[model samples]
Target: MNAAVHIPEYFEDCDLVEGEDLVREPAFWLAHVLLTMGDPGEVERYGVDASAYEAMVDRLADPGQPWPVLRVCFTGGHTAYVVYANFEDENNVDFFVRHPAWGRLGHLGQCGADEAGPGLSWAELISLAASAQDGEEGLSDPSQRLLLLLPMLGDADMPGGARDTVARALAGCGIRPDAAGELAASLLGEQDSTGGPRWTVTGDSPIAVCSSPYSPRRVPLGLGISPEQAQALANALHGSVPPTASGGFTG
Candidate 1:
């Protein structure tokens, strides 16, 4: 009946178990966190939009692939994660901030309160964030630092600026309006042994990097192609990488 009565507590310091089961079903995760953690309104958009994201894996996930697992912990602690999402371009790189259990820090709560918040109050989080700038770590540790985002306007309870921050963070993990853009951007194409396509598209983040920023980065656009396919894609893209780019990256 009522969801609040059975709220769960935070996970252990480094407990990484069947988090996949929890993330696979977003509604349960949201309710569990909201009830157990209380709706701090830091990570989520509050209703449908937030629900759409949290439940996305369960709603439309590839069962063939292993469910993306996550871990949770208190301030300055570490959890486990299944993916290290990121995206690289010519110069920069961006990552998805997964707390092993905290899910996406951007989606958990306001900075520092949720996974990235280190369980601190808003005031503490702000101060921590301010302090990070003076040190070697600039918001690298979620416990010690926090993302200062507050909902400022519109249907989105999250501020436009804050929303952008979350948006970029989500992008770091390949969560965006165009989920397939990664495959659509390349002028070249090939397929993996499992018939997976080897193409290129501008992704928000590269695979297997879970940090933050969620900005656009140089995505490693490499594909393994047979001689025939290589020639074709190369021709399409105005020739291969001049032998060096044309060489086999792995073997």
Candidate 2:
């Protein structure tokens, strides 16, 4: 953690505490595992475009006022397991509300104490969230706090398929496949990689898969996604939309 990042007066007022010890927290650990294998550049590599990626992150940060609990999440690593805030407060919420595609879904909008609303409508909320900024203080790294909130994707605490898929996706972004595999295991709390957990990605059209030398299971390629990519998919799965899309998600 950078000392410069810790000097924000708002955090102090919010009773926020910052430290590396956050890695020990369950939330941070899980998030770290996922991010360890995540590649922040997936959108660019996959041809999703930089602006689209940024817009996706913005949407995740603040879903809207009615459904303020959700937040955006993405991989962050200078090295070691790292996470990024995606969304930490009201400004993000307000921006998402006013954005065209995302604003219509009232209950799913991202919300926090920082927003002002006549109870902002869907359109208003998307617009606000899209326009919100970090101000001169710069952005806050609330990765530690956001991880605790990542919803369990399956019946188990961590979804083995989701973790592996995310790692594979990161690998496609140029990370080493072995490292991505290890990261997947770490994020799912599956410390040992020996057990062959079967998984597959069904592409829009069928695609060939290669079996891992280490495991009998075949790995999916086109299905690969980074932490941010995973988060974007998750938001879509949860029924939210990006502001630019008339329907929220791109078909």
TM-score of each: 0.21, 0.23
Worst 10 residues of 1 by lDDT: 149-158
lDDT of each residue in 155-187, candidate 1, tens digit only: 111112332332332233233324223311120
Top-TM-score structure, candidate number = 2
Native-referenced Cα lDDT, model 1: 0.25
Expressed as tens digits, the lDDT of each residue in 20-122 for candidate 2 is: 4333323333333233223444434333355645644443343241121222222221011111323244332221111122212112211233322122212
> Which predicted model would earn the best lDDT?
2
Q: After superposition, how far is residue 35 of candidate 1 from its true place, in Å?
A: 14
Lowest lDDT sum, 10 consecutive residues, model 2, at 74-83
